[model samples]
Target chain A: MKDVYFMERDPYAPIRHCYGISKILYEGKSKYQEIQVVESHYFGKILILDGVVQFTEKNEFFYHEMLTHPVMFAHKNPQNVLIIGGGDGGILREVLKHKSVKKAVLVDIDKDVVEVSKKFFPTVACSMDDPRAIILNEDGFKYIQDYKNEFDVIIVDSTDPVGFAHVLTTEEFFKYVFEALKEDGIYVGQSESLHYHLDIVVRFQKALKKSFPIVDLYTTVIPVYAGYWWSFSVGSKVYNPREISREVDVETRFYSDEIHKNAFLPPNFYQKILNGNFKY
Target chain B: MKDVYFMERDPYAPIRHCYGISKILYEGKSKYQEIQVVESHYFGKILILDGVVQFTEKNEFFYHEMLTHPVMFAHKNPQNVLIIGGGDGGILREVLKHKSVKKAVLVDIDKDVVEVSKKFFPTVACSMDDPRAIILNEDGFKYIQDYKNEFDVIIVDSTDPVGFAHVLTTEEFFKYVFEALKEDGIYVGQSESLHYHLDIVVRFQKALKKSFPIVDLYTTVIPVYAGYWWSFSVGSKVYNPREISREVDVETRFYSDEIHKNAFLPPNFYQKILNGNFKY
Candidate 1:
């Protein structure tokens, strides 16, 4: 069989796969753009929604934890937050756990993903109907561009950097993130895998480094991702992502202050990339 | 579809997985018991070798790297070393890179894995036919039980605790390991995933804690196994795994002293486990 490339675009990150079709799970508008377990030669069951991989037999928690915690922990008093492209509500659920975060705004291009997640992935992506959450069916890039410094923390929970989500990984989008944040605002977005998308990660790092004074890259293990381990390039307007405290009020299954401190400890292979000795 | 369970009895550890046929990659013997991939609705890919996963799409490298590097780097002079159950030769390739390591002995139950890895995974599992290496098709458990404290370093590069490998993760086997160490001998092995298999990891940890005075747990990112982030438990008789001098002799695509040190930073969840809380 020959390889076929599949791309799922969200504002946060996009998933790209090259595989022959052996099976497809679910496909329709049910709250979320849901798809069932397909015939995956590498991984068994792959769950997709609105072109984004929601679950797999392998690993998913790493991506969920890394995407939510660092920025949430960095903000000392993140009362209001905005999540662009997280229709599945995983980020919203994580944000709601922070007692200090009184309100959240989730903007997604598609409403089908939200509906699907509400039905299937209730435990993880459950904050869809939270009292503190405001769901907006809109374009995240344009939404941020039109908004002011109104958010304490802004998380771009989009798909990969291609198709609709392509612009979100650029310096132009980060400028909007900076403009959309409070003075001490912090931003986190989906950085691709180091193994498969090394060049893309390097480009994002460069763009974020130029846009923000303090930018750091952290990674997690995600089975369905091109590379099992996925990275996030973080940019902050005022604070350093390094200053971690034991003052987190959120109850998380995977994150803690110790993890917050440990996340910054990049592998030497990655250290070489940060030090400019290694490129892609 | 009915679920089928497979057991991978590496000389070190043994792992069992329940999977659908879609999860099975390759079966039967070629150069190695090469299994491509199998999907699990819950666990991800069940990478079977002779009906067991030698290297799944998930947490295989965490075990492989941790078992090879700590002891290889800790010794001031490691001229000769013995590896039991690393049939895939991933560890052999890592050991060969240390210019100080002149000879490496790899003992495996199946020769098919070694031969197949020599063909497919040539990068990490390369150097199968190197001049400085010896491939032994024998029972590693018996081999260790017979050999006295002769080698500088001995690595347990086996599978999980399922079938034949179940003996390798026991106290009695570790006693054999202790006997097979030099005055300053070091040993490392694949414990289990800190996320899903903490019960096994804790059992392995408790067993090693009794055998060796110094026992530590470290982690790395592996996406294809049960969990994305995987942990390895290390046991030392006299040397500390963290006392690494930043001097690296061999060029590496992945492993390094810097990477070596970071691997020991257990996540906070696992930190609680090591601290005597095995709740997760």
Candidate 2:
């Protein structure tokens, strides 16, 4: 057996995180990006796309639960939800956990990612066959533009804001997301590392402020991510993302009602970060 | 010029975070540990000891501020302070910021760690010559056994609890620390990462629980550290480490009153982690 390792380099920063690989479960490319399913030395199985780690078996709940629950709990009743680019189905699994979610539409451009995830990561892709899930193999950028006042919550779980995926974070695309949502809707997307990509975080938050009344940034410690301080940007029409409208009633490893509130940056700290007080 | 990279392989896990190096400022070994001061491509100068990153110029504030302030503010009148193994002098600089601190003594096993830091990291080592500060080069494990009811606060800023440093975290050593502190004293040490070394954290906190009435864990995101979510274990005799005794009147980049409270894990989340609720 040959010793193999996966080098997860951050294009935004001059650093990388390396993971020792025990076995390569699957390796192939979709029409849009490269994909791989590798059994890791420590973190069980890992899903990698375009040279970036999407999640690991041991740590998927941190990213999935955070990306899903805050938005779901913030909305009064998330009867309908839109998940863009979550082809791995982790977000869809979390969204369906909400009793209020009548339908969850997951629009991902890469069919191979979903297929490989369903094949290699059974636990993460466990909820793909749920009746409430509506999987669409199309670009969410185009799919979101077709709906009007449809989704109660919209979550962009796409790759980094680069290449073709860049459109998901643009102001025009934000307009599409705002229009696709109901009058009182909540929106969120995984931004870059808060430490490495402050400029992008500020830019994304400022752009969302143009279309939404409430905008905020929250962070979590992702073990496999480049900086470990992975961030999520939130935009809400009426409700504050910091306040939870629903009590947590789902099975989760990381998300609790208290962790939800504590996860968001304090107002003064957030303002200071936006004001460029941080030199790092 | 060659492109050099610093591979910080975590001894606890089969993972490493790499930093691109622009220049090597210093590389040598003291009697205690191997040391290096290097200029990084994105994170400015970094101080490395025994293949582990102590702090980087770009993001030292997050670690230093987090390690210093909560214990400082938790005490009503923090007049006498003791620091064990903070050779970089970053903790000394923050400790000197409090007007209430009348005397601060720092003891380390390696003099080279202090010398190289003063030469290459002048900003971090700026307060070395303070009149009220005392610098001693000795093993803190042995140096701590000499005092009884002496200091208001005691902090251990040493390397990871490995090799010879392991003794500093033992229950016997914690008993020594308890005897060295005043009736209303506080103690804090750099525990392992919350994400990677939960077992070590639990063990250290459990050990501290035997010596102190109030023992808790706090965390902050350190970009260059192994897991990024660096944690500190705190034990106090009288004061609740969560409350602030004095206002933040010092100049700091990251520690504020709200962040001081926010840096701590929520009580329920902390309990859940202790109860083994989280998988990651």
Interface quality of candidate 1 as DockQ: 0.20
- Give the poorly placed runs of model 1, Cα more than 4 Å off: A1-27, A30-47, A50-52, A56-62, A119-131, A223-226, A265-268, A274-280, B1-48, B51-66, B111-132, B223-228, B274-280
Per-residue alpha-carbon lDDT of candidate 1 for residues B105-201, written as tens digits (9 for 90 to 100): 9989777766656655555466787899999988888888887877888888776677677899999888888888887888888776765566888
**What does candidate 1's lDDT look like per residue over A136-230, in tens digits?**
98888888988787999999887777767788998888888888888888999988876556678788988888778888887765645545567
- Candidate 2's C-alpha runs over 4 A off are A1-3
Q: Which docking band does candidate 2 fall into?
A: high
The superposed Cα distance between candidate 2 and the true structure at residue B102, in angstroms, equals: 1.3
Candidate 1 CAPRI level: incorrect
- Candidate 1 lDDT at A257 equals 74
TM-score for each of the candidates: 0.78, 0.98
